[model samples]
Target: MTPARQKLLIVTRHTPLPWEDGAGAYLHDLARYLATDGFRVHILWLAPHDRLRWKKIWRLPAPFARAVRLHLPGALRLGRRFVFLAVVWLPFKARALDRVRRALNTVGLAPPRRHPSPAPPAAAPLWASPPTPAELALVVRFFEKHRPDVVITNYAWLCPILDLPALRRTCTACLTHDIGWQRAALSAPGIAPEITRDGEAAWLRRAALLVAISETDAAELAALAPAARVVVAPKACETRAPFAETTSRSLLFVGSDNAFNARGLDWFLREVWPRLLREVPDVSLHVCGSIDRLVTLCPDGVAFHGPVPDLAPCYRQAALVIVPLLQSTGLNIKLVEAAACGRAIVTTPAALPGAPFLRDAVAVAATPGEFAAAIRHLLDQPAVRAATAARALAAVRARLAPATCYGPLAALLRANAVARHDVARDLRVLHASGAHPPQP
Candidate 1:
C-alpha cells in the first residue's frame, strides 16, 4: 500500500497580497513547492491574539490604552483578532507612516492624516508578546483537527508556540523573511535591543530549521542560534524566453510603500532620474505598486500607477527594470522576477544579499552617476540589453527553478520532520540554489 502524504501546517500572519507582495511571496512559493513535492501543505493564517498583555499594555502611555479601549467595541463587532491587530499595529503603523509622510511632505509630496501612535510597550515586537488564551486555544483546536507532522511558523516571533501540546511532537520550522529584531527595530525604534535580541534568539533557537531567503541571513541566523539548522530558500521564478524589446525607453519599478522602497525611490528620483532625463530626453519612468504613495518626488517624465492586478503587461512594456535598493536584507524577489520576465535589470549591491550569483548577469551600480550611466547604456544599446536580459533569464532558469531551489529542503523534511534526533547525517550543507549532492 502507498503511504499517505505527510501533513505540514504553516502558522503565519501573512497571505499573498498583490500590493505588498514580496514580504509573503517566498512563503507562498514554499507552500506550493512542498505541496508539489508530496506533502499535504496547510496554512493557518494566524492573527494577533486577543487582549494585549497587561504587562505590555500598562507600560504604554495612557493614550495607547485609551485607543485600545476606544477600538474594542467596533473590534468586538468584527472579531478578537481584529481588535488585537488593529488596535496594536494600525496605530503604530499609521503614526509612523504619517511621520514619514510629514518628513517627505517638505520634499513636495502631500502628507497623509496624522494619528499619534505614542510609544508601545518596551520590548514588544509583533508576536513577541505572550500569546493570548484565545490564540492558544485557536492553535490547539486547529492542531487537534489537522494533526500535522510538521509545524512551520512564518516568523521567529511565532516560534514560542512550538512548545504547546498540539505541536510539541511535531518538527518545528521558522521562516525568517528577514531578521525579526532588525525589522522590528527599524519599524519601532522604541523596542529595546536586548528584548528583541533575546526574544528572537530564544525562539529562533527553538526551531528545528530556520529557513532564510538569503545565504547572508543563513549565516547570521546560524550564528545567532548555533543549534538550529538554517537553510537558504528564496522565491523561485520560472524563466521565460526573452521578451520583445521596444524602441520605447520606458523604465519600470515595482515595490511596496516601505522604508526600503521609499529610501531607494527618493534617492533615484532626486539623484539619478534627472541625469537619465538629460541623456534620453524622451525617456519615461513608470512606477507601480503602493510605492506610488511613499516616494518623496513625482518629477515630470515619471508616472505612478498604483497597485495593478497584472505585472506581465508592465514588464512587457518596459525597456528595463530598476531596483535601486539602498537597504534590504532578504532576497529581492523583484530582481528574480525581473530576470524571470526576461528584462535586463539595473540595481545596487544592497539588493543582492541572497542572490549574489546574478551580479554578472545584470547591471550593478552603487552611485548616482554610475547608475544613470548603466540605465542610459542599456537604453541606447538594444543588442547589449538583449544579451544582458538573456543572461539574466538564463541565470534565473539555471539557479532558481522550484525543484532546484527546494530539493534540499525536501530531503531535509523527509529525514528530519519525523525522526528529528538523527540530524548527524542529514545536516550537510545544502543550498537553495541547486548546490547539493545527488541521492545515491
Candidate 2:
C-alpha cells in the first residue's frame, strides 16, 4: 500500500490571500509551491473581530443599533485604544470581574444572561496578539483532529505557538522574514536593543529549524541560535515575459505602509525626486500600494494610486522601477517582483544584497544625486533600459524562480520530519529500557 501523505500546518498571522504586504505574498507563494510539491497543507490564522458586522449593525433601527453597539465587545465597539486595553489590560485585571460573577452566583441574586452568538462577519482581520486561552484551546483542538506532521510558524512573533503541547512531538520550523530585533530597532528608535535581541534569541531556540529569507539574516539567526538548524530561503516570484521597449518616461514605486517604505519614499520625494524632475522635465513618478496614508506631503509630478489590485498596468506603463530603500532588513520582495516583471530597476546597494547575482543586471545608486542620475539615464535611453530589464528577467528566472528557491526549504522540511522521527524513536527506546534521555 502507498504511504499516507504527510500534513503541513502553517500557523500565520494572516490568511495569504489578497496579498497586501510582503509577508502575505511570501506565504501565498510558499503555500502554493508546497501544495504543488504534494504535501497536504493547512493554514491556521488568528481571525480578528469583524468590522463589516458593525457597519451592518448601523443599518438597523436607531434603538436596536444603539443596543447592538452597546452590547458589542469593547474592542469592536470602542476602537484601537480600547482594543489594546481589552487585549492587554482587561485580561490581567479580570479576577475582580470573576469574583463578582462568582459571588452573584453564590447568592442566586443575578443569573448570568446568555447572549446569542453574533453572525460571522464577511471578512475578518488577522489577529495580532498572543493567543488567549480560548484561542489556544481552539488550536489544540485543531491539532488533535488534524495531527499535522510538520508545523511551520510564519513569523518570529508567532513563535509562542511552539509552547503548545500539540507541537511538542511535531517537527517545527520558524520562518523568520528578517531579524525581528533589527527591524524593530530600525523602525522604533525607543526600543531597547538588548531586550529585542534576547526575545528574538529565545524564540529562535524553540524551533527545530529556522528559515531566513536572506543569507545575511541566516547568518545572524545562526549566530543567535547555534543549536538550531538555520537555512536560507530567499523570496521567490513568478517569472514573466520581458517588457517591450516603451517611450513612456513614468517611474514606478510600489510598497505597503511599512516603516521602511514610508521613510524611504519620504527621503526619495524630498531629496532625489526634485533632482530627477529638474534633469528630466517630463518624467513622472507613480506611487502604488497602501502608502498614501503614511505620506504627509505630495509633490508635483507624483501621482498616488493607493492599494492597486493589479500591478501589471503600472509595470507596463513605466520605463523604470525604483527602490530607494534607506533602511531595510531581509529581501525586498518588490525588487524581485520588478525583475520578474522585466522592469528596469534602479535600487540602492542596501536593497541589492539579497539578489547579489543581479548586480550587473540593474543599476545601483547610494546617494540621492546618484539615484537621480541613474533614473534620468534610464529614462533618456530606452534601449539601455530594455537591455537591463531583459538581463534582470533572465537573472531572476534563473535564481529566484519559485521552484529553484523553495526546493531547499521543501527538502529541509522533509529532513526535519525524518530527524524528528528518529529522535522520538530513540526516546521511546530509552523509556522502554528504563534509561533517561539526554537533556539540553
Candidate 3:
C-alpha cells in the first residue's frame, strides 16, 4: 500500500494576505510550495480579533472612538483576568444583540455591515484569538484532533505554541524571518539586547529545527541556541522573464510602513533624494506600499502612490529600485522582488545581507552622495542599467527560486518526522521491556 501523505500545521500571528506585507507574501508562497510538495498543509493564525473588533466599535462616533481608544488597552488587560467568565458572559449578550440586529434587519431599519473576505492566495481555515484560556483549549483540541506530523511556527513571536502539551511529541520547527532581538533592540529604546536575545533563545530551544531566512541570521541563532539545529533558508521570489525596456525615468521604492522602512525612507528623502533631484531635475521618485500614513512631508518630484494593488506596472516603469535602509535585520524581500522583476537596484550595505549574491550585480552605495551618484549613473546610462538588471535577474533565477531556496527546509522537515517516529518507537520498545529511557 502507498504510504499516507504527512500533515503539516503552520501557526502564525496573522493570516497572510498577498498584498499586505513581506511576511504575508513569504508565508503565502511557502504554503503554496509546501502544498505542491504533497503535504496536507493547514494554518492556525492567531488573529488579533480584540483589536479589530475594538477598531470597528470605535468607528461609530468620534467621541466614542476617542474614549474607547484611551481605555481599550486597560480594558483588555482586565478582561484577560476574567476571560473564562467573559466567554460565558459575552455569548448570551452576543445572542441578544444578534436577535436585536436580526429584528432591525427584518424591519428594514438597519443595513448589514458585513464585508467580503480579502481572499488570500492560500486560504487555509483560520483560528483567530484574543488568546483566552478557552481559545487556547480550542487550539490544543484542534492539534489533538489533526495530530500533524510536522508543526512549523512562522515567526519568533508565535514561539509560545511550543508550550502546548499536545505538540510535545510533534516534530516542531520555527522559521525565524530575522534576528528578533536585533530588530527589537533597534526599534525599542531602553531594552537590553541580552534580555531580548535570552527570551527569544529560551523559546527557540523548544523547537526540533530552526530555519533562518539568511546565513547571517542562521549564524546568530546558532550562537544563541547552541544545541538547536539551525539552517539557512533564504526568502524565495517568483522568477520572471526579462521584459522589454521602457523609457520611464522614475525610481521606485516599495515597502510597508514599518520602523525600518520609515527610518530608511526618511533618511533617503532628507539626504539622497534632494541630491538626485539636483543632478537630474526631471527624474521623479515613486513611492509605493503602506508609506503614505507614515510620511508627513511630500516634497516636489516625489509621488506617493500609497499601496498599489499591483506592483508590476511600478516595477516595469521604474529606471531602478532604491533600498536605502539604515537599520534592518534579515533578508530584504523587496530587494529580491525587485531583482526578480529584472530591475536594477541601488541599496545600502545594511540591506545587502539577504542578497549578497547581488553585490556585484547591483549598485551598492552607503553615503547620500554615493547613492545619488549611483542613481544618476543608472538614469543616464540605460545600457549599464540593463546589464546590471540582467545580472541581478540571473542571480535571482539561480539562487532565489522557490524550489532552490525552500527545498532544504522541506528535506529538514521530512528528516525531523522520521527522527521523531524513531524516537517514539524506541520509547515504546523501552517501556515494553521495562527499561527506563535515557535522559537528554
CA lDDT for candidate 1: 0.75
Kindly indicate the candidate among 1 and 2 with the higher lDDT: 2
Go through the candidates in order and give each one's C-alpha lDDT: 0.75, 0.77, 0.76
TM-score, cand. 3: 0.78
lDDT of 2 by residue, 4-109 (tens): 5567887765534433677767876777677677667776655533332233232223322221111122333332112323555555668777888889989887
Candidates, ranked, lDDT = 2, 3, 1
Candidate 2: give the clashing pairs: none
Poorly placed runs, candidate 1 (over 4 Å)? 1-3, 48-133, 183-195, 420-440
Using TM-score as the yardstick, the better of models 1 and 3 is: 3
True-structure lDDT of candidate 2: 0.77
Number of the top lDDT candidate: 2
Q: Least accurate stretch of 10 residues (summed lDDT) in model 3?
A: 65-74
lDDT of 3 by residue, 1-440 (tens): 11256788877665354455777677767776777776777766444335334343322233222211111221233321212234455778889889989999899899567777888654422331123454456568768877888888877656667778888777888888888888878876686553377788887887778988888888999987888899787878887676666688899999887889999999999998888888899988899988777876778899998877578989988989999999888899999899999999999998887778988898999999999999999989999999999999999898988888888788788778867877878899999999999988
The estimated TM-scores of all candidates read 0.74, 0.78, 0.78
